[model samples]
Target: MSDIRDEMLRTLDRIVEANLTIAEREKADGNGPSAKLWAALTEQGMTALGETDSEIPFADAMALVARSGYHAVPVPLAETIMARRLLSRADIALPEGSITLAARAGGQANLVGVAYGGTAAHVVVADGDSLHLLQVTNAVVHNAYNQAGEPRDTIDLGKAKTIDRKPLAHATDVLIAEGALLRSVQLAGALSRTLEHCLTWVNDRVQFGKPIARFQAIQHAMAIMASEAAAARAAADMAVEASEKQADWFAVAVAKSRAGEAAGKTAAAAHAAFGAMGFTREHPLHYSTRRLWAWRDDFGSEVIWQSKIGQHMAAKGGENLWATLTEMN
Candidate 1:
């Protein structure tokens, strides 16, 4: 199993991620992830990596997503994986091409900020009590990009009939929690990569007859960045494990909140350590940091998930808080 995991990671790093050049990312920002890349991913069985029928274990699937974050794949790979998993559990046939989830319904069943919304062949959206699977060919698509230059568009399902529908077992809030879990894991991977870049830059950059990494100030910043990245990775690991066991939404909320906080702190520290170069497009640091900023706000932001955790704890009262947290451990 470890061998398989290592091989999988290598394939992603060498094949899927290595080919995602700056030019490819620029093209992806204008058009969606290239069809060739998608085809390559499909051939690797990555599109359905987490589905019920997949031979890959859930933990391995989640690992793939985290690696994607590290590489800043700039594709809807994570979205498509989750979409396939959701549809499979609901006993729906997986659609061809890319699939992505719509945001939790906002009053009128319109899903906005959908990853790959502009190009996805199908979208799974929350509609009343049902999860509506809509074919995107006829829907209204407003093409847009997130702060990270990833495709995040609005799709209005305007009178479209559901190709297949299933009763939503969980509330919209639960859906957000699930999305948060995914984003948290992805953020963890991005944060880890950002820290790596910062460390590399500081070690190689010399000033005042010594490497910047030798300075106390830079050392302190690097320590903070590494700690935050570690925390994010731990939180994401907790979320993935809990998800595999079918734990409640509270566990997911905790993971999302902690990871989001870590992402913000780590991004700031990394940028500070890298100095002006980190901010430029020529450097790849922006790729991870920008995605961290965008992803931390996606699903539910840190504040939102923190509120959910606080509210639940408050209702449980101060006395039970220790027990509740310990139980998770």
Candidate 2:
């Protein structure tokens, strides 16, 4: 099974690299994923990994999303897979094109910062206890973009009518957990790529007739960046493993918190190493770093998840804390 997953991920990486180059990503930047890229992903059967019959296990599906992040592919395939699975479970006919998830509490009809909201054809919104499928075109979309130039639009559900509806208990919590896990895996992938860019920059840039990589301080910072990247990826892998079982909020909370923290550290280190070069739009480094910054805050920020972890530990008390924490999900 692991062999199959590795083969699939390698194949996915190839497809993404071949089809969505930095130039292509830029062509569709601030708008959404280009049609050509989406076509390539769909033709490769990369969109239905989470569906039971797709042969790709749910945990493996998470890995695919992480791989997409590595290439900085500007698409919401994570939401598309999860949304289709939810609709499938509800016996709702799946719609074509991309679908984004928007989970919110209470009866808030307006969803702020809906990832891929501007481009996706449909949105599966978990509004408190009920799930709603609405046409993105029907909604009043206030155009917006994240720091990475990915479409992060404000969707007004007030004007839109639900195409399908179903009762889903604890829908908000379920969707939030899903969002956090997906973002964490993505963060992990982006962190690794960011580290790679930093390493390459440090090795190539000359300082005082010597590569910056020769400097002890530079090497130390690079080492820390690598460690954070490794830890973030490990946390993401653990979260995916947890999905094979209960996939509770606790598992995703840990992953999101860790990965988000890693993103901050990794991005800062990359920018510091690259100096003014990293901050420029002409540099490829910003592609991954900006997404890392935006995604870490999307589902839930590291601060929010860290506080949740603390609160959960406090409730368990000191005696059972280690056992409970270790055993979570």
Candidate 3:
């Protein structure tokens, strides 16, 4: 398992180094992840790393992506992984370059938008319970702004022309639940990067004739950043484990709730500790922090996940919730 994890990390490093160059160029061009980077990643099988039928350990995959996030490499890691899972379940060949997968209608329906959806080669809409597959072409897409300033668009199935239909056997909730977990993993990566940037900033920036990191106030801030990062990692790891083990939805709820809150707080602390420099376009800090802000709201926000978990606990007689979490691990 360790060897596999090392291999995954090496692969991730190669992808990041190569894509970092592209990301820099894209920033110059006022664009995001380039087509070439996406093509290269797909060619390298990154987009297909964790298929629905994957045997690779979930922890290893999550760790690999966490490292990727540490470098702020611009790739659609979460969306691509979800796309692979959906395609694998449908036995459909995965598309190349900039694909987005959505699970909605209470997970009964799954949708894929290609080339960022509007420009994708094909879009697959599936009704998991009914085993229905619908192919839509030239998907109608809508621009949606996120905190990261990256390109995000929505696919309108009503405007899509159905090409084929098939029956699927899995529960829709399964896909939705998996997506939520996958999102948590992505947030783990962003959160880790934000912490790294914050620490690096504190160590280098001098204050009152010494490194700011030496100041007690700055030390306290750094401690909080570290604590939040640890919590976020734990929550994300639990979410990934639950998804891999097919655990109860309650586990997913807890993990997402904890991770979402931790990520937002961590990113906020990181930016605050760095002062004005962190917000500048010249620094990479904003990239990770902005993405953290966006992703914390993805899958399910802190409010939604907390409410769900609280409701579950209340229904379970509100007894020994802490014990339940400990036992889940």
Candidate 4:
């Protein structure tokens, strides 16, 4: 496992370097960079990493994506991985670089203004008690906006073809859990990078005859950011482990909820530390902070996850709540 993790870290370093270059170019050109990065990832077999039936390992895969978040790479890791996993379950072969997936809200099939719909080849619709897979061949994809100035859209899937089959046992739940965990991991990475960037900036951009990082207030804020990043990473790891083991859904919910809160708070703290510079479009900190905010609201927000966790615990009764957690671990 350690060997695999090390290999993934090395791969992630290469990916991050390349992605940073591409992201800079894309930002200059004013185009969405996710598609190009997705093509690169597909070449590297990223989409297939955790989708196989042979007890596929996910730790390395998760680590790679988390690092991608650190660099604010625009690739759709959650969407692509979820699509691959779902298609694999349904015995569908997803062509590399040709398939895209995204999560939509509101339990309605024809709703618009969801996340990352413009470049998607397919959309995963999670309605009540059922999951619908719709191909976006003829769908109208509007060039909607997200925080990073990335291309999002309101997909019109009314005329699109659909699959009526029921998903694999607990498939929707697992996908949601796994997607949230992945997003959380990415948020942790972004938060860590932002905090590091702020600290480095303060150290070099001296004020008052000394580095701003020397100030007690800045030090405290940095400490909080570091602690929150660690907590988010730990929670995300727990979610990933639970997903790998096919543990109870409550574990995933708890992990995701904690991670979401951490991501939101940590990003805000980092931005505050960086002051107005972080808000400028010319600065790179906004890139990470914007994505952090957007991703936190994706794949079941903190409030939603907390409600789900509470409901699960209540359903299990007070006596069985602790038992459920233990069993999941």
Candidate topping lDDT? 2
Worst 10 residues of 4 by lDDT: 97-106
* TM-score (C-alpha, index-matched) for candidate 1: 0.95
**What's model 3's lDDT at 329?**
68
Off by over 4 Å in 4: 22-31, 54-56, 102-107, 111-114, 127-132, 162-166, 245-248, 315-320
Better of 2 and 3 by lDDT: 2
Q: For model 1, where is the 10-residue window of minimal lDDT?
A: 168-177
Instruction: Give candidate 2's whole-model lDDT.
Output: 0.83
Error of 2 at 227 (Å): 1.1
| Model 2 spans with C-alpha error above 4 angstroms | none
For each candidate in the order shown, give its overall lDDT on alpha carbons: 0.79, 0.83, 0.65, 0.68
List of clashing residue pairs for candidate 3: 107-172, 113-117, 114-117, 114-120, 115-120, 131-166, 131-167, 131-168, 133-166
Best of the two (2, 3) by TM-score: 2
Expressed as tens digits, the lDDT of each residue in 1-329 for candidate 3 is: 59988887787778767766734634623234556666766777666665656776657766766776665555566556665566666666555544555544544222432224544444445455532233444445554446676545566666666544444555456555666676676777778778778778889998889999999988998888778778877877777776664424776777677778887788778878988998787787877887788767765687887897778788877577778878886
Model 4, 1-329: lDDT tens digits are 57867776677678656765644545623355455566666676665565656344666667766777787776566556656666666555554543444444445556464445656666665554455676766775566666666556666767766744454555556556666776788887887888888888778867899989899998898888888888888887777776664423666677668878887887788777777877776677777788778878776898999998888788879998777777866
TM-score of each predicted structure versus truth = 0.95, 0.94, 0.85, 0.86
TM-score of 2: 0.94
